[model samples]
Target chain A: MEELIQQLKEQIIEVLNLEDVTPADIDNDAPLFGEGLGLDSIDALELIVMMEKEYGIKLKNPAEGKEIFKSINVMAQYVNEHRTK
Target chain B: MTHLGKIVITPRGVELNSQVYPTSQIGDALLTACYRSCHADYPKFFKMDPLCRLGFIASELLLQSQDEERFIPREDRAVVLASCNGCLHTDRHYASTIHAGDNYFPSPAVFVYTLPNIVTGEIAIRNKYLGESSMYIVEDGLTEEELVQRLAELTFQDPVTTSAIIGWVDYHDGDHYNAILYLIQK
Candidate 1:
């Protein structure tokens, strides 16, 4: 779970391009959006696609994943339950 | 009098950039290169209409400051973009995507970028600039002075057009693009 979270952090940093941020700076349980990481709606969509391509989780509606993706802990829990692969 | 300002040129795609993305495509490369050069994040841009991406980048460079609000005024600012292709690359991409499969005809993604003035719209939104805006199409390159003269004449009707964004955005199928922006001040 820890490794997965770290990998996810790297992916997030790369995909969303938080240029000034690094993996170590991200807290595993910290929120990824607003206040926590300052991500926005567009970042959310990118994350949705990233989740589908990398984790085999297809989010029918990006909005539904908002709560699940609030933090790495929540995202991992949701992914563990729903990943197709 | 010649409008005074700085000219910033950006070239997209290495091959095309050699001639600097000349209006003609002389080399072969993936279409993605065109989108990639202007943005570090491809998927984010791929999801957006190409015009939006072009506008965002161009505006970022044209405005080029955090305190742009002072330069871009509600009444004085105007936007003018000149392009030969005028979204032709995006149109071609969309046609191929739809032609390949009938089930999906309209690619909202590509379709939205298929406008000549989208760059202008994007500039307006990013800067919150509510001013006279227009797009011009030219068959061949015109000197910067000529472009400024043309734009000034067009915006002459507006009294407060002291500063403006004028540029040329042209892209081709071989993933080549050339965008030049100049901020004109009277």
Candidate 2:
């Protein structure tokens, strides 16, 4: 679980092109959108695409992402449960 | 048709307001070097595709020394830009990612920049210019005459537009790029 979270942190930074942010800076339980990382709608779409491409996890409904991508911890847990690859 | 400011960024160096900037460390990568030289803390610049970055830097240079609020408000200024390639560089990059069926990983980050107007959007987002922003794809190349004609058409199109940032920003391949942006007061 810890390794998945760390990997998720690295992937988030790389995929989003967060040049100034380090993996250590992202708290696992902090929200990924709004106040925490301040990522917008575009970032959310990118995260959705990343989940499918990286983990072979297809999120059929976009609304489900609101809870699934609430935070790094939630995302890691969801990916761990549903990831095909 | 009064010119407020002009910035020309070429493979050689950058020329801002008719004065050639120091091109010491700006060897071949002129746009990247110029962006670095500006010392602006816009991290979103790094995420933009090369064409958007070119337009972004050019617009920044044109607006750097001006009192932007005096002549144009957020909704009064329009960005009318032209480009030859029109996101071809990013299109090719995105294609490479998806073409290899077995190894296909289509990146949304790269895919989002597949439109030419995204450059205008980037500038608008950066400067908070909520006015009309448009990009034209000039396949052959954009001549000065065509640019002027386009600018005239854009200015007269809307009564609300009083000022505009007009330019030809083209990026081909990775390193081949050129931009000539002008701030014009209508």
Best by DockQ: 2
Model 1 error, position A45 (Å): 2.1
Give the alpha carbon lDDT tens digit for every residue of B133-167 in model 1. 78777876688667767767776567767677766
* True contacts reproduced, candidate 1: 0.00
For candidate 2, write residues B7-90 as lDDT tens digits: 888776789999998666442366667777887678787788888888988888788886555334479888888888899989
Interface RMSD of 1: 7.5
Candidate 2 TM-score on chain B:
0.91
DockQ, in order, for the candidates? Answer: 0.08, 0.57
Give the poorly placed runs of model 1, Cα more than 4 Å off.
Answer: B10-73, B86-118, B125-128, B136-138, B141-146, B171-177
lDDT of 2 by residue, A17-79 (tens): 887789999999899988867787778888888998899988888788899989999999999
TM-score of each: 0.64, 0.87
Stretches > 4 Å off in candidate 2 = B22-33, B36-39, B67-73, B139-146
| Cα-based lDDT at residue A49, candidate 2 | 86
DockQ for candidate 1: 0.08
